[model samples]
Target: MPVFADVDTGVDDAMALVYLLASSDANLVGIASTGGNVDVDQVCRNNLGLLELCGATAIPVSRGADQPLSAAMRTAEDTHGPAGLGYAELPLHQRELTGYDSAEAWVRAAHAMPGELIGLVTGPLTNLALAVRDEPNLPSLLRRLVIMGGSFDYRGNTTPVSEWNISVDPEAAAEVFDAWGRAADAKVIQQHQLPIVCGLNLTENIMLTPTLLSRLAAASGATTTAMSVLDSRGTRSTADNTLIRTLEDAMRFYFEFHFDQGEGFLAHLHDPLAAAVALDPSLVQTRAATVDVELTGTLTRGMTIADWSHRWGRESNAHVGVGVDPAAFFDRFIERVGPFARRLQADR
Candidate 1:
């Protein structure tokens, strides 16, 4: 079983958690919330509520940094809504309080594990930066870190040059990259690879297809009904109707913000693709290259510069995902979620 540590602050991040729960392969050890799309407190609250909705109350939830290390804090409230949950008005569910401080807790958990654990990050790398600094051996303890941030050649959602996660805290991201580079230098990890980066270039290749939508709808109905019955709740709020509701809301916001100004009906699942990559690397096309984060370029602060030229003679420090097989990815996604869908129906 693999333990996953996620630092999330977006509605899509919540949907990613639901996907992880539905997948039997991911042994979710804990979740750490950070302030990116919303305040730190709200992110923590949303994490608990989402875990409860998915019936994953046993999983520990922790709170992380409230702001960036050195940069002015910024958020995507317009895209994720005021609460970072698509503006869906629903009462917060009561749950047990988190037991540890987020940053320190993450460091402790990583060290306590027998071996390196899978790290999944969907927000700014602030918490990770702090963890590496606090625990000198933290980077070595990570089996792998799959980050859903940055853009290689595609258009960015934040600015013309930067992605939201990286833009939120470029300084922190820089530190993380540097730390990982040092760890890779110390040991020759498997496959002669550095950090595996699932940037926008690959995630954009995965779009919401009609078939995928239909499967999601079916699963949504069954899960909603099962949850309602199990909880003894007579009625399900329209806002809390199904897990797909969160996905739908995220797609709506993403499309409006990026492609159609809110008129488009669907958007690609960027974060989910990152999660899928963590589960199986063969699903994507990866190339090892020396990658650097631009922290001073006025128009490209958060941009990841991959030295593909090989002209500069820089050693490759990261594995950059360049492409993906969309058809195969869709098949795997549906295949994994199908069992969960069937289980939901059978339970009903």
Candidate 2:
């Protein structure tokens, strides 16, 4: 399927992008950058840089919101590091930023592919909100929308009641839910809405362990090309090993963060699972809900209010994640993703 990605390009976001690019199922048409993990400009660089590394620079990329729709931008530098890739590094590139407005890029991609386009959003919903504002029929245009935010049945990561992506831009999130018939003013979903939400509640199930990292390392030995994203001239590093090395460098910080969280040297992959669910909704169990972003509560702002029980007598607008098989999810990921990484690594 043609996939349009909106990303903040943090570590998890990078993981998601790499997974999508490596997957045989996803035809990543474009990426719209947003400010969350880092600044919007930096996120653009990260997106392009990753493409350059994978030798997939042909994909279109553009800058999106530099700030949220309303709230002040709050980046996760402490979590993803100053560059949003932790300690991982990529060579600078002169890749052109294609669109003047990210909303245009988003809507254009949908229009080009129409019902075949699958949207994967792993950041604040600023670009999507802008696109929906431009085209109210956007929900009907997309085949499905998979988002990596919220904590419906679990606690928050940003604050007592917020996930980083939603907390950073509750207004935009609210707009998205409203458009999809998940907010207070939302109407009932018609016939063509497929919105699946993969929140921390479900993503926290599959944590990245050393075992998975070892498998990833083994798959990182794919071929490479002379053209490096770091520079026009290819650097002297072992071409076959660059991919694995890059992941390792970035994940060092991620592991430490999880260790401190008492998770024992492991990181919960929050975004990639959403990408996976975008391709196959059956990967996780869910409940129908009318979800709204909490914007007024001093202690609960940015939280996703998913009425799993139809508490408000509203039509369900989203498939809110409730459960997933951890071992099965990881097994499927490694089995499918491992071979693809090996193929991408061989690009050079």
Candidate 3:
């Protein structure tokens, strides 16, 4: 299956990229960059650098939306670190970026693949919204859209009522959700499967535990069986010696953020979980809902209002992720990418 990723190149985004590269099923066609974690330029660079680090540079990279459709840009530098990769730094990409911008990349890739492209979007919906505006028939073209945004069950991460990705560009999210829910022409009502949303409600459950980290932090030189967790492991200090140190460095800030949130040395692996669910829909248990974004509200602006009841008489446009198998997801990630993990103590 052809998989397309739209990312902000945050720490978790990098993890998703690597996971996709390592996956046996991922025929990754291209990656489109958008502004959220840092900016579109840095997102492109980060995407390229990760592809290079994973030895998957053959994948094309496209730079997209420097800002939201109609809102001022906000970045997660504090959460993702200054460079967006946390502590790890990657070699500057030698290959030139793809000519198509983010919007163009989404449109072109979808058209080329027709109804076979499975998209995982892990950032603000700026690029997607722009693509929809350019190609009104975009919703009907994609095989599936799995978005890592919104917060329906609990409090939001950014605001009292909004999650970071959706809060950053609610208008764009609104357009994307509405597009999938209803066709471009009002007379033509399409019953599209609601985009699967791995929102805060579902993502908060996939926390990074010490055991998971220890398994992933094993030296690439270590001999192991398939999906085997090394009986003996290196200390946290020596974890930087692993090839996946780049991800380790990035998680420093994430760990700290989680600590501040009273989560205790654990960071919710949000984007990667979205990517996992996208590639394998069975990874998450979902409930269909008529989902929409709040573009104008005094306190609930950017909030994703999901009507679970049939009172709205609206078609369900989003499959709200309600449950996930954390262990299965983590195991799959390690099994696919662990072989490529090596020792690298470099922070920069």
The 10-residue segment with the lowest total lDDT in model 3: 226-235
Candidate with more favorable, higher lDDT: 1 or 3? 3
Model 3 lDDT, residue 313, Cα = 91
* Worst ten in a row by lDDT for model 2: 226-235
lDDT tens readout by residue for model 1, 185-257: 6664443335678888888778764346556656444332212112221222232334444455444455444
What C-alpha lDDT do the candidate models reach, one value each? 0.70, 0.81, 0.81
lDDT of 2 by residue, 1-348 (tens): 899999999998988888887778889999999999899999999999999888788998989977899888888788887898877898777799994778999899989988889999999999999999998888877888999989886889989878888999999988898788842234433433547888888998879875677766555544433222233221332335766667666776777667767777678899989888888888998887888898999889999998877878877778888888888777767776667667765655
Q: Kindly report which residue pairs in candidate 1 clash with one another.
A: 256-262
My TM-score estimates for the predictions, one after another, are 0.85, 0.91, 0.90
| Model 3 bad stretches (over 4 Å) | 184-193, 219-242, 342-348
Query: Candidate 1: misplaced stretches above 4 Å?
Result: 87-91, 188-193, 209-211, 219-241, 253-259, 310-314, 338-348
Task: Say what the RMSD of model 1 is.
Answer: 5.4
Query: Could you say which candidate leads in lDDT?
Result: 2
